[model samples]
Target: MRILGIDPGLNTTGYGVLEINDRKLRLVEAGIIRSKPSGTLSERIQEIYDGVTEAIDSLKPEVLALEKLYAHYDRPTTAILMGHARGVICLAAAEHGIEVEDYAATQVKKTLTGNGRAPKTQMQLAIQHELNLANLPEPADVADALAIAFCHYCVWRGQRVANQSADP
Candidate 1:
């Protein structure tokens, strides 16, 4: 199964593709969709929408995983942009007939690092180790994207096991 994990942002939306089989993972691709800050809000959103749509087309993933937004009092503008990014992401997935799952930040970190409040570096290191990568994936955005993918893999595997046991 192939999964596409997205870290949404108006400035740089990050994405990572992972192929999984028998609990093993292989990184297919990882990158960010950058939008120029000089543009109007509408133009930036359009750029993000177009970039993410192109990624979905190229990857053709079986599942889509999105990092859920966690609010902070100091960053209302960040929260608003995050919402915009998420809107475009949902639209792209829906248009492609892909089921999207939104995982809370804690859920993803716990699944990856065994701790809900694990630091970003810990999550990044753990993901690198779990995926058997020699070096860390750069630009925290990419790391977060990969962690989202890993979280889905772990959760999906658990669900599959339960279903198999429930069946005759």
Candidate 2:
């Protein structure tokens, strides 16, 4: 199974693709989609949509995992804008016939690091070790994307195990 994880933002969206085979996970690709910093909102949205659509086409992932929206009282606007980015991403996935699964950011952190409130550096290290990468995943966003993907893998594996035990 191939999973694509996304950490969406207006300026820079991060994405990671992971392929799982017989319980082994391999990184297919990881990178960021950058919209022009000075572009209009509509232009930027279009750019993000296009970038994600391209990724979906090229990566051909079976599922897309996303971080659920979190809104802080002090920065409600940030969440609102992020909602725009997420909207286009979901649209792209739907267009490509890919299932989308979303997990809370805290849940992703806890699943990977044993702490729901793990710091960025800690999360990066955890992902690095899990993937057996030589260095920490860089720029935080990429690490976040991988964490979201890894979280889904953990949940999916657990469900599969539970089902197997229940069968006989």
Candidate 3:
């Protein structure tokens, strides 16, 4: 299974694609989509939509694992903008007919690090160790995106195998 993980933001939305083969996850691609703050909100959304569409086209992931909206009391503007970015990302995934699952930040971190309150560095290190990467993915967001994909793999694969067993 190929999965695309998204970390949505108006200024710099992060995305990573990974393929799961026989329970092993391999990183295919990872990057960030940046938008100008000076642009109109609608324009920023369009940019996000376009970037995500391109990612979908390139990666052709079977599923999309997205980070759910978590309220940030210190940054109301960021939260609102991230909501818009998330909409664009979800819309693109839906248009491509990929299954979408949202995971809370805590859930993702816990899945990756064995602790919900794990720090970013710990999560990044865990991802690097799991994926067997020579170096951690840069800019933090990419690592977060990869962590999201790994989290989905851990959570969703169990359910998938259960369904298959019940089927035959």
Candidate 4:
């Protein structure tokens, strides 16, 4: 199975791809999709859509795991703009027939670090240890994307085990 995790943003959308073979997870790719900082809203959206579509085409992930939208009362506009990025991402996944799963930031953190409020540094370390990487996953966005992907793996593994146990 291959899973693609995304941390969406207007200026810099991050994505990570993980491939599982015989229950071992491997990092296939991880990077960010950058829209021009000065581009118009529609132009930026188009850029993000194109970039993610290209990734899906090249990487061929089976599923997309996306960070769920979170809106703060003080910064509702941030969430609204993020919704645009996420919308295009989902559209790309749907166009390619890839299932999309949403995971909350807290849930991802808790699953990876055993703490719902784990700090960014801690999360980075957890991902590094899990993947046995030589260095920390740089540029927090990439680390975040990887964390989301691993969280889905953990959840999926648990469900698979439960199903097998229930099988007659």
Question: Model 4 over residues 1-168: C-alpha lDDT tens digits?
Answer: 999999898999989999999989899999999999899999999999999999999999999999887787899998899899999999999999999999999999999989999999999999999988888998899999999999999989999999999999
Mark the regions of model 2 whose C-alpha exceeds 4 Å error after superposition: none
Q: Which ten residues in a row have the lowest lDDT in candidate 3?
A: 78-87
Q: Residue 139 in model 4: shift from native, Å? A: 0.6
Please give each candidate's TM-score: 0.94, 0.98, 0.91, 0.98
* Cα-based lDDT at residue 120, candidate 4: 98
Cα-based lDDT at residue 146, candidate 1? 89
List lDDT for all candidates, in order: 0.89, 0.94, 0.89, 0.94
Q: Roughly what TM-score does model 4 have, to 2 decimal places?
A: 0.98
Worst 10 residues of 1 by lDDT: 68-77
Model 3 residue pairs with clashes: none
Model 2 C-alpha lDDT per residue in residues 1-92, reported as the tens digit of each score = 99999999999999999999988999999999999989998999999999999999999999999998777789999889999999999999
Residues 12-118 of candidate 3: C-alpha lDDT, one tens digit per residue: 88899999888677999999988888999999999989999999998899999988778899998878878888887889988999899989989999898779999
Q: Write the per-residue lDDT of candidate 1 for residues 6-68, one digit (tens) a residue.
A: 988878888999998776789999999999999998899999899889998999998899987
Question: Clashes in each model (backbone N, CA, C under 3 Å)?
Answer: 0, 0, 0, 0
Determine which window of 10 residues in candidate 4 has minimal summed lDDT. 66-75
